[model samples]
Target: MSRESGTATAEATPIHAQVSNLRPRDLLSKEDCLEMFRQVYLARYFDVRLIKEKKRGRLKGTLYSSHNQEAILVGALFGLKPTDWISPIHRDMPAFFLKDLRGDWNRPDRIGMSIEEVCAQVWGRVDSPGRARDNWSHIGSRSKKIIHSTSMLAGTIPVAAGLMYADRLNGGDAVCITFNGEGSTAQGIFHEAINYAAVHKLPVVTVVENNQWAYGTPFELGCATPDVADRAKGFGIPGLIADGQDVFDVYDKVMMAVEHARSGKGPSIVECKTFRAYGHGDHDDDRANKYRPQEEIIAGRARDPIGVCRQTLLDLGYISAAEATTYHAEGKNASEATNEDFPPEVVDYLNAGIEFALQSPLPAAEEGAMWVFKENN
Candidate 1:
């Protein structure tokens, strides 16, 4: 579905009354704040670029843009130690940048993919770890402990439980973070996984990004509960709802959950109340789409995640307005210049990646023959 980049005009910009007085320093250190801003900016730019590429017919497959939910992924992941594990769905692409990978699974906070790699991966380049084997969003690094996601609804929930169980067997204290949407909560697997995790006290955090709509269905129509977090009580585990638009609230709640799980507490559920700010994908025309109302879309844009974080950073005297503006520009310009010569490194990396992906041979015909499994014949 075709959709416009719901950027608010000066006169149309909604004043965010949701900004809280909680200081960033009180919750995050100086380094954490800086990294948070960098990832948020990068994710925003990456999202915008993906939209543009889809419009231009460059990116293939479904384009589920994480236009507004950057804070939830960033905040939840920032609190994770490198030794911890995370499993992300299609829209949680920004999370790939929060870690540092050094081929050492024992190391904490492994580095994530570079912007060029993410862009190339989305573009379906062979250089991507997926090797163009599937949709670009399915990328997972074994060394980094990122489990590749499937397109199935709530499919990974059970797999996340398995990871936690294995970790428990190995006597590791790391937690497993998995993401799902409000709609997925309706699926049977979601309930089964949560029930098992709760019974076992598995170290896993189930983050439900309640972006109000599950595909074309609104949360109200799909579920009777007031909030998705309430489902946690049924599982007998702690559940909390956080302002998905606010980074501090998300980070705070997720950190608390992580601590709880690390201390041998059962899994917890965190429902982030936010909006998708885009059609389900580029294939759905949001303007003509009857399922999602225009008024709700407009209202969602007013509480932009990046804008909220910028105002909070300024209010806390952590960063100047100029610095905030610069951060955005850096993210946007870097994304725009990936093909241009201005940023030689980015251009070079992207070009080489694109060339390798495009020129690389498709999987050989015989390669599939090797993966065959035979049951004692």
Candidate 2:
């Protein structure tokens, strides 16, 4: 030991301190961490499996997975009930599954989904409530009276607002949640949704998953504003920010925002800062390499949301290491078993969804030929 001979060395900043402002709680419990870890793991596993299948040419088209960005997707859905409705974009599948539909349950068929579910795709089977077939989207809340499906970017924002409006009109006590990517904030539709929701004082919560990418372009390149939440002020709505990686933080912020909207205080915009682990799609052969730097991707992996939450859970004694191991294994086994359950109808449903668009009569050739805006005509 040094006796006044050597000066004390300074230690690097602690991670908890570095992110003090981002968190929404004093301390995270082990169970909180474990739950977040499990949620993120399920989401990541699904994405990874799909990507693997795509690489093997098993998948016919793009699989927009939220691999690294699990925190935002699952975190916000924490403490959510089945009755609450959610609107999402394609990339937000984990949230959709955990919130709306259960891909986990394994029935005898194990092929997953029934012809009845398939028949609802955009064409609306007689048994279907919507009556139009093509209902495969994410999120299903039975307790919160929620809806399940994703909208195009800011497209769902307005739809969510409408749901809240309907609730208010019908004197319903439920809430509406809509999620989108950071880039969607730049779209005019996002503003309109917020404006109308705020003006009407609807019970809607708009969440933006800021993972720094929209399609091939990096978020920084596409988003003009430094903080997307700041845009909420223009609509006279409050803006909340949270650590998406930490599921607890997401839960806290979302719950608070939902309460604010439900009480007739208008809507809120929550920007969850997160990182995207996988590419926008499974196939990278034709990716726009100009965007998404590999260095950035490597740097982001250091703070895995699932790992962080697991550590917190361990610290809180919510779950033991052995239990975690078993938990994870069980989740994987369940997933493997689930794939078998989804047979012809699962694929058929997807196929039928596309067919709904295709089967619709094409624009009449004669009409197209006759309806041109030519000066000669």
Candidate 3:
């Protein structure tokens, strides 16, 4: 199958078709492709490790596993410029560290949060950008260009649009990508924000991680269209779809949307079709298993994002057959997979973050009252 072939819907006209010869991924060197593959491993390792920690009572709050949805984070983030902003929701914890990670994982000047900071947020330590005042997935850095997300679904679209509008006024070309689940598309803010963005031609790319199931509700129950990308038409913007399991496909589609937004075309919706491998959160895991069909769960996780990306690399001759079989992390849950299943560097990188989080102090008790109200100077 060609790279462009597969679950990517044909509803939205292809933006890259005008270019004819060069798709975004086509511009990637062999090293860039390998880096994308490595990032997938990093994302998977982060989610599984966090699940293990929460299970062992070492972490707090809910664990929203991004098991099958790793491609969306890795692919969508890979093509972004360092200055571009992103708003990652509860299930997108890996995105905090994944943004601007392409060949600059350790660079202090990169416009993305550090692994240590993300780990601190997960651990609820004082070193968190929000100083542990907010819980997991609530931390954001203005310097890093990441928007802090709230519990309200699809709420950040307006914030992202407003941010980009201000950036344009200031003569900045920065684009903001807001990540949300398919369920959030049902919210009124989703329409209102996108409509506003369309009118202003703001550089906002709304990435709907349509993972089939939204909490206890299925996609069919909440959405009128089979593909969430269909919603983009109403706003007079492009709505492209990608095989959420394929990192390359996601990169191509999202990069198209990103380019469209950056060129002042306006906001676009790139719906990456995927499945929620686990429940809405760790606490709801058992209930999710019971509510969703056994066959559906099995089928949903069949195309592991790591495995898909690995196969693509193999097809491209980037890795030998022997190398492909070296580490088998895909298709295994946190309990089933071990550290050896991933690259040692990936494990070590996360270990450093965990160590930092462990040594960091908790927020002072008075912090709860400190940010609550403002005092007259």
**All candidates in order of lDDT, best leading:** 3, 1, 2
Q: What are the C-alpha RMSDs, in order, of all predicted structures?
A: 8.1, 11.0, 2.3
Candidate 2 Cα RMSD (Å): 11.0
In candidate 3, position 363 carries an lDDT of 90
Superposed by TM-score, candidate 2 places the C-alpha of residue 99 at a distance from the truth, in angstroms, of 1.0
TM-scores for all candidates: the values are 0.80, 0.68, 0.96
Query: What is the C-alpha lDDT profile of model 1 across 1-377, one tens digit per residue?
Result: 11112111111111121254442236577666756765665566556655666667665677777878888888788768878888888778767655542133223344566544555577666456665566757887767677788888788778888988998899888888898888999999999999999899888888889888777887888888777777887887877777888777787677767877887877888878888877777676554256777787777767777777877888878888777664333223223534332223323434454454455554555644453566475
Winner by lDDT between candidate 3 and candidate 1:
3
Q: Candidate 2 vs candidate 3: which has greater TM-score? A: 3
- Output the number of the TM-score-best candidate: 3
lDDT of each: 0.69, 0.59, 0.90
Q: Which scores greater on TM-score, model 1 or model 3?
A: 3
Q: How well does candidate 3 match the true structure in TM-score terms?
A: 0.96
lDDT of 2 by residue, 1-377 (tens): 11121111221122334557433344545445555566666666556555544455543445666765676777676645445667767777545445632333223332222323322322323333223323434433333344555445687778778877876788777677788888888888888888998899887888888877677777768766666676776877777776767666676677667767666777888777776656666465245344666677666556666666666666767878875444332222222434332233333434443344334442334543452466673
